[model samples]
Target: MFWLPLLIVAWVATGLSCTRLCLTAYRAARPGATPGQGHELTLYEAAFLSGGPTRVTDLTLVSMARARRLLLAHTGWATVVDPVGGDDMERSVLGAIGPGGQSPIAPVRRAAAGTDAMRALADRLVTAGLALPEGTWSGVAGAVRQVRAAAAAVIALGAVALLMPAQESRGEAHVALWFTLALALNAGCLAVARFEIHPYPRWASPAGQLLLSALPARGGSDLTAVAVRGTRALSDPELRAAFAHQDTAHRSH
Candidate 1:
């Protein structure tokens, strides 16, 4: 009966993790107020829906750089050429770059993404039903991760149960068979969750995802490519190098 305690713990973990995942998924898929009625997403909006605030910041930087309004050096510094921002996002980026007109791209991206303008953009998308509220996608993703951890814990517990001393009547094989049932439960739950909710969205809701999918395929413009595929879509090698350098620097921190 010593293995019974471990079995209880395994089942408890499985139940809690799976329940959290299911709830998170259900909340994420719930309908928003005033669903969008063929509302067209602007490039900025599209970028946000497709990849969240960081993507919006990336698109803005790329567009400004391409238009010669901003200079993106291969060394990861951004220089303001035009001095005037065309929109709120651009203004936020400019503000992040500071009045001196030059700043590192990594800090600029992070700063801009947390600006009031970005929050307003998220609010607009949520109101329009094209995007989920902030953190919904993150919640689902977190829940999924918890479930994965639970699955691993179940496997470990099962192994421990099999390794423990057997009772007078029960054998190691018998204990393993019982623990296998718990393992099967964990496996089945994980499999179902993967099938139904794998590849969780980073920001967009189901509606936003649909809108993103419906966007025209990338073609004919560097801005369009950046809007869809992010900074890597920039055709300018220096710009690509600049962003890559920024990413490397940011990760190093």
Candidate 2:
């Protein structure tokens, strides 16, 4: 019927969209086929690429607190014991503490996450193929979700088209052809979409992901041990809290 063609069109459109989504997810999940020759990322860089700006700030706060350069009071305030910083990231963190050199952890985290220095650092990591570009990661995640939702929508529409009262009397002739094709299309899209979804932690190619899993924790005194447990986990409770505070800042471009 006329409606059958329209439903078929809808199904085809959705199937095509789903395919695009799957491709995007795959590209984001595995940005490149080849991983960097050497895994030489600094602890902070690894944390940033693995977990984004939030993790970077976490490492910074923990490092400063451990080094006695900043006091991360248990009461959620940061007081700079020393104003000097060794790098741009550290300086960004100190600036986040504000001109007074003291502020609540949440505001400080927000500010630090928003700094140009953070973007430069993130870009450097991406250039080394250690991190996923921010836009690419967000696009992939959104596309993955859209594809999944489209799968369901197309299936529902196809089901309605097939099971309609008018279609019931149409016999097994076209019903089998149209219905089966629609169902197959929807099912295939859904299955592929599921398989293409990537990990939510951060962007890493498949090879880099494997390497990240195999990478060891940053080892030093108790401080390094506390900030980074390993490539996969964050060790410090305070640092973890900093993640909760990141929605306020941390621009991505």
Candidate 3:
């Protein structure tokens, strides 16, 4: 039957895509090692796990601005009032601002996030099982996207199968029923994945998420709040405006 070939293709695509998603989920969930007992994440580590390197950069900038070591003007310019960096992350941000001691906040954020310091931070988190290894979250997210594409392909193939003239006595309804089985399999796999493996982390792993959740909640300009919630936690309108302007400037580029 002409529809048979299309049905075979649909089934093959569904099986392969679903299998890949399952494998990716399994690998992402495998924790490397348990962190030491009573360990707590530093503000930098918390920022990285909560929102990645960009968040870390934002925290450093806000922290320094509050301490008067750096100035984040509402005009979106960052001026280094204190050249000395308190830590590696701080030093990275300082370097991004350059020897002139002034730079645009947007480019500084991007440059700081891409530095060797960020890589080292990621490596440390991965080693402690607090964050997924590089690309693991992306791998799972990619697998999920592939499964979605396969589901769409199955639907398209099923429609084509229904349109094709039957060379045998079997009706169009029978062909459709066969195709429906493949479609159902794809849908069921996606539903299961949504519950079991979805909400893929952009940074932190399961262990890291647990730690994040355990942290005492802070609000309104608290450094921890800014670290956990990004610039939104900033109580200062000027600080928020600076970061907001920085974000708009970055997106425009």
Q: Please report, in order, the local distance difference test score of every candidate based on alpha carbons.
A: 0.81, 0.64, 0.87
Every model: Cα RMSD to truth:
2.2, 4.6, 1.7
Predicted candidate 3 versus true structure: per-residue lDDT over 119-196, tens digit per residue: 999999988889888888888888888889988998999999888887777688899898888888888877877887
Per-residue error (Å), model 1, residue 70: 1.3
Q: What's the TM-score of each model vs. the native? A: 0.90, 0.77, 0.94
Q: Write the per-residue lDDT of candidate 2 for residues 110-179, one digit (tens) a residue.
A: 7888899888987776776666766776776676566666666656666666565464565545654665
Given candidate 2, what's the lDDT at residue 64? 79
Better of 1 and 3 by TM-score: 3
Backbone clash pairs for candidate 3 read: none
Write the residue-wise lDDT of candidate 1 on 162-186 in tens digits: 7788874758878777667766776
Of the pair 2 and 3, which is ahead by lDDT?
Answer: 3
lDDT of 1 at 210: 73
